[model samples]
Target: MTRETSEQPPEIAEVLARWQETWPTALQLWNPYVSLREPQWCLTTAEAREAGLQDSFAMIRLRGLAVVVDLETVRKLRVENYALQVLAHEIGHHLLVPANLYDYAGLMMRVRLALAGIEDRAPLVANLYADLLINDRLQRTMGQDMASLYRHLREKGIGETRIFLWYMRIYELLWSLPRGFLSCDKSEPVLDADASLGASVLRSFARDWLDGAGRFAMLAYPYLIEDALHQQALREFAHLSDITSAGVGAELPAGMAEIPSSVFDGIVDPREEVLQNAPNHQEADSPGRAKPGSLTAIIPGSDASTGPQQRYMQPGIYVDLMRQIHPDVDEDRLIGRYYRDVVTPHLVPFPVEALGELSGDVLPEGTDPWEPGDPIEDLDWFESALLSPIVIPGVTTRRRVYAEDIAEPEKEKPYHLYVGIDCSGSMHNPRRTFSWPVCAGALVSLSALRVGARVMACLSGEPGSFMETRGFIKEENEVLRVLTSYLGTGYAFGIPRLETEHLQNAKEKTHLLIVTDDDIFSMLAAPRSDGQTNYDIAEQALRRAGGGGTLVLHARAEWRPQEAERLRQMGWVIHYVTDENALFDFAKAFANRFYRSQGNPTCKRP
Candidate 1:
């Protein structure tokens, strides 16, 4: 009998009512997957909230089918028609049983029994059978319903699932469903004949009940299934393998070797063609061949190749061509070398007791010298020596005749320190030794804090490489945290204006210290209409504090002498420190000069 005409079974009605009461939001969210003409199952927000039904679930039974939804989930959905989609998907599952009670019963029994054996050796066997069944039968059934669902949703300009095969391949099994019948004993297997017959009878009763439910789902929630299918298709497309061989001319470099076939297969885009030609084949094969002595074919010699030559292009030719085009490219440089050169040398070849001596006073007690979290005392003592600047008493000095009059204490201006660190992708190269920047930044920050200077630290790389302290003044740790957050990023967008926006607004003396590779000098020096180098920006900004502003340019030692001279001419204090160990000395000297000059104002003149 048709479900609409048949009396509503009380247990089936109760289950539907419970589903509605338990997860109204999930049901609503899945409405797009549901079909129209499916029976309406009423659920309230309070009931859904009580069950914590935030995620969606599809319920299938011999008697009927339904989708339960949480109320909060429905409210959060971007699409208002989610409820309709959910209902349609439930109907799709119900429609799988249409008029085939015996088949439906047998399928359900097998699925249920397979699910039960999942925890033991039988799990593998059960899973294999279930996978086969779902892939072959269930997917075909779902595909049929999906076609209708797709047409309905597509007509409305909703979403559609174009690559249904991808989903069919990945999601053949209902991974979420529990395997095995928990109520039955593990050792006892259900008799195949009895299960088949019983399932058929139960399915007949279920078919009548679901006929009403399925119609409601189909009528009310077509888009739910449609959108899900669309998403599934997109996911499958992302994972699809597109294998192609390397091009004919492609080859490994001379002295270099081919990548292992297995290794190459993992990352090689399947779409790329493999190279097969050998180098110098054409020239060797067409020896002594000459073209017609026409103006287009030959100019001076009146002889040139005019016809196709059959010669294998060796893979080495392409490798050589690539090497010429990108001579400086070295992939190995990208991986960190810090462990070999910096970390290893300092920690190894010496006893732990030697660490304290090597580190001097800075390394703290109770820390390992080799580990990252090792005690500072056993590592290096330079930081503690630098700390002396903060505690040293100010000494009075005789003013030189050319010295400007010292300002009164009341008028002593607070200094603004702007530190720009280059965190571009190139900075990540271990060959460049990036740890210097990190350590230098940390030391500079600590020193700035000790001197009561307001510090603004920034990392520049890509369009959004900036990371800075926001209204951050007090906590030194906070500033360090911001600095450490910088990731080596891709190409940076804007010019490195190290001096302008950061220091220009300060009423106090300004110190713009830029730590970067020499590569950035040209970008910083390109003339602005205002006739200002980045250094000029700082000079103008610090002029407000009675010319107390200074620019310090720290770059790699390999920078051209001309670059240093040009910066010096621009009135910047330039220093070249090639390696990390030297950076601490440079900072120490710079800090000494800065602090000592506070007492002897005319000690060093620009």
Candidate 2:
């Protein structure tokens, strides 16, 4: 009996108390790992909302592997007695289809690609597909009456929407139910054929669920194309959308930037698959050919594992796609990680400090026990043998410590990096577009950190605002966060940024690298608060840095002859590139020249 129609409303305490006892059987249904926590049994709808179960009686949160159920809603729906099936289905979401946050994101990513124009429908479609896989497994393999739960839900109304009918029919086919059973007898040849294709996809890709996400979405595409039908289906099946918000407040999944080429190859439409499989089917010019004007050729998903050349989604597209997956993900972190992923492949080896091989260090002063945790190279086999014929780690192993002569020169430490980039109105926002300047900055800044150098990154737009690290720091994220941020303000890199206290109090020699266009010359010429212009600040900061400076300009070499010469005279090396992409080449060459074993040498400036 429904809760309201009964003589008295069911006590929420009594419902929760009863369901609490059933939680064990629900968990045991999956034969899950012993440590899996029991589902959170919220006693009321308000409690359910707080537990992240939005519109459903039960929901799963991938962030904490949390399964929440509203006992109030369960009682209202009269499925309080079906606690095992409902809770087990929620558990199946955690253990099966889109189990963890990463695979959930992967499933959404593939579905979004398939539902290209109507991508917002992806979450609904993904939730439905996941339910199909989970419910099918529960019903057929595990002997759970998942169909009965749908039948109880089907009492409200069985809409005539093609997507809804096709969806329900799939369940009917999977459970060997009659045609009119769950779908309200709304059967048609097209609906039946499509339902058969979907059922086949569900069973075929049960083990490899992510691979079938695109195919399932493609099957639902035609039904969802009409706005009216899509909206109707959404309203009809709103209760089943347990995982629609699964990625909310979740960490951004790693390695999503690189999509495998085979992923797109697997994005086959089931209708097309059926056509090709038919005996009467005739081949086109080529089988599996992408439609004209389609992105098949452009969006090449080369696997990094198999080939050196790996393809990445555009920064803007990736950001949009990820936002759909994770609504509240930090945009700065996304952009920072994006550039990091892109530049990782191009990163050269961290410069090896060429401390000329240790000289005058032959005197063995003492021997110490060498634990197994110590480097194998440190073990002195002769001394260890003398202690015992058989060597035993930490017991018989010995390492010889030698004293070096005091006359040897101290090893040189790497110079700190001060990277300044112009985030002027002219610059594109790296969050929205691929900013080569930001990419190049990430490359160099991360390289410096890899070599154990402290770096202070600054993004400046003069006459407006600027941002930078607290001081010289080794944190890659902090440096990258600064490099990738966009300040669409003034017209140039604020030359006065060089006057920061960090540079003034530098203990080690610091290299200043500024990336900007010819517009920086305009900012440099503008007078500062003091009578001295920014030109004086640049020269003075260069002197204070003590390690010299390089100004990488994305401008024609002949564009600003006099101003460029003035900076060159201030002991600044000037490199000009007509194309912005060459900044990466410049950073690579600059790191190679200064950090290599060849010793401190000037980069060949253009």
TM-scores for every candidate against the unseen true structure: 0.29, 0.80
Please provide, for model 1 over 1-606, each residue's C-alpha lDDT reduced to its tens digit, 9 standing for 90 to 100: 001212332343444554444344333333445433333332444664343222232223222332334333333322222333344344434444321233332232222221221211111112222222222232243332322222232333332232222122222122221222111111112122222222232233233432222111111111123445435433432211110000112221221111112221121111111111444423222111111211232111212211011111112222232232223433232111111112221211111111111322242233112334444334333433343433322221111112223323322323455666667776643222234565455555555565455677666764445666653265665665555555576443124344444444555555666666665565556577766675455445445333343333345545567766666665566666655456555655555444323432222222
Kindly give the stretch of ten consecutive residues in candidate 2 with the minimal lDDT sum. 301-310
RMSD of each: 24.8, 7.0
Q: Local distance difference test, per candidate?
A: 0.35, 0.81
What TM-score does model 2 achieve against the real structure? 0.80
lDDT of 2 by residue, 453-568 (tens): 79999999978999999999999988998998888999989998998999999998989999999998998888666699888999999999999999999899899899999999
Candidate 2 positional error at 490, Å: 3.5
Which sections of candidate 1 miss by over 4 Å?
1-414, 429-434, 462-464, 490-496, 499-502, 525-558, 595-606
Q: Candidate 1, which ten residues in sequence have the lowest lDDT sum?
A: 239-248
Scored by lDDT, model 1 comes in at: 0.35
User: Which parts of model 2 are misplaced by more than 4 Å?
Assistant: 1-14, 32-34, 158-160, 226-228, 276-298, 301-310, 345-411, 525-534, 591-606
